[model samples]
Target: MRELLYQINEHLKTVTFIIIRDNNDKSEAISDYNIITLKFDDIIKSVEELKLDFQRYEDSASKLAELIPRAEKPFKNEVDELKSLSIYNSNLFAHYYSNTLCNNAFNERKIVNNSIFHLITFRSIVNKSKSNIYSLVNCIKDTLFANWSFKNQGEDNPLCIEFNKPIRYYRIGNRNEEYIVADAALFNFFFDFKKALNKEQDEDIINCSSDDNDSDGSYTSYDVSRESSYENNHCKQIECQTFLFIPRKRKKRAKNDPCKDPVKTIQCYFRSKTHKLHIQFPNNNEPEQELKKSKKKFYKKIKNKVEEYKIEKQSTICPEMKKLLDEIENDINKEFENIKYKYENMN
Candidate 1:
């Protein structure tokens, strides 16, 4: 029995040593540093001796059971503690090794979030959907590299790879300017990543693919050109300029809110100024008349307020107050001019 126990102890100790050495080697390779060294042989021998001692106690208890018939409570506690200690040691080793590798990868610029690679996926999907794929591709490349200053970190980490599955986008309505809806799983993934990266919700990110078409024979597509310059950034910029297309049953308009008003209803359907032309207005003369009326009303209100203030002050307004008001008016005009300049040079 003694010889059998001794041999078992020796084998267990050898196996434990091998496991410790392998773990250390793996840690070193990943971190590129030899920071941890364990005398596994010595540690394993001590653990084996404890195991052998416990086995002897178990054998003694079995023999004692025939005579006394009571549980070995003390040995059970010791064995539980030994198992817990082993787990604690393993956890400590893992924590130290993982944290080191994580820190090193961060320093080397290799541990970026998964969203960076998704931008590439965005580009690929857009390129596949477009008739002029090369032009779209070039435009995206220019925006990503030149405009937003994006840089790539190689695939040393798993986060650098594309998603495990392709995300699907569906068009919501028959309108050409409709927003696309993404699959639930894809939406969750995008939502989580955007939240983590502090990126704004982009219409392009959920763009409709040409593959999905609504019953009215229209598909939703993305237009990167329509994205605001202020909102376009390295992390949020997407290349997919085409809209998504989804199918749905025709919706019935309420009696009070009839769909006959294409001018008003179309405003809610499309996003851009160009698409607004699709909705036929009641008459061209109405718009001109409305503009003239609005301008006249604005000037009339301003003049009435100024006249009221002058009457209250008995036409003796302070010179400093007048100068201050003039300066404020000048500043407002200057700001308007600056805004005009910016808009003029936007193209």
Candidate 2:
């Protein structure tokens, strides 16, 4: 599970770099917008295919579980693998779909001009984590649902339950504004369940070792408790340290003040959470880290190119264009209100 989490995290980092660089480059951004539209369509079709696959697997597991009697030990490994795979595919679908939404929102002229892009950027991060949690929870629910057939005597039917719903809305900084975010409830549940599962497995191992007939291996409860406690404590520390910094209006700063002169205002508006695990578990020989560093450099170049384009565009503005720009700005303000209205309705 940890490895899977790491893989998803790494994927998100790559996706972030791609998105930031692509959005920052005028020509590239246009090209990417086109490509993403096509890719998103394909991804939607792929999601349909995955849903079918999940349904088929669920049916097969249900049948198998029903055939296995209550007294008989079922093939746990096969069933578990199927459940996990279904979850992984579901998560992949969610991630790709969310990414498509993000790309579309970012590319939308109205959305970008209205400054809704800021909220979309934050939501993208939340979605990245939430998708994984949703996937795991759905998988567990499906597995348990299938197991229900085996538990009921002479029952050929399986009962399935809906997975826990995702969480949304998180307070940004110390502000009253609540940012629409993905829920982490599923992930928290999975974390606790995993810990309990590990504890049970450890007890089974100890019992096996102490038994005269069994000779599997020996593992002390002390060792298990120490490792589990360490992990729990580490996670707690990370959560305590994690914070989102949202920039609020300074004492004398006006609500309509533009963040043009000092970039500090822009910096203050953005927030990021610090993860101590990354520093503690640094990979000294990671080729991946080098690749990431290179990606960052490339993104920096792209950003510069975009800034140059913006300057050129500004300089080329004639009287007619200035009037048009003013009209567009007015339209943007109205459109922003509409977007906010829609968002509020969603809430």
* CA lDDT scores, all candidates in order: 0.29, 0.31
Cα error, candidate 2, residue 155 (Å) = 41
Q: What is the lDDT of residue 167 in candidate 1?
A: 24
TM-score of 2: 0.19
Ten residues in sequence with the least summed lDDT for candidate 1: 1-10
Per-residue error at 62 for model 2, in Å? 1.7
Please tell me which predicted candidate would have the highest TM-score against the true structure.
2
Per-residue accuracy of model 2 over 176-274 as CA lDDT, tens digit each: 321111222223333223333444434222121223424332222211111222444233321222111112111221243321311222221211001
Give the C-alpha miss distance for residue 171 in model 2, angstroms.
3.0
lDDT of 1 by residue, 1-347 (tens): 00000001221222111121243353232132322323434433333333222222223222322222123455344333333443334442222222322222222222122223666574443333332322322332232123110112122321111112222222325532211222212222232233222223222333333443343422122212333324643223343222212332222233433123222222222112211221223222232222223333333433554566568764424454355344434443444345334544643
The clash number for model 1 is 12
Residue 138, candidate 2: Cα error in Å is 14
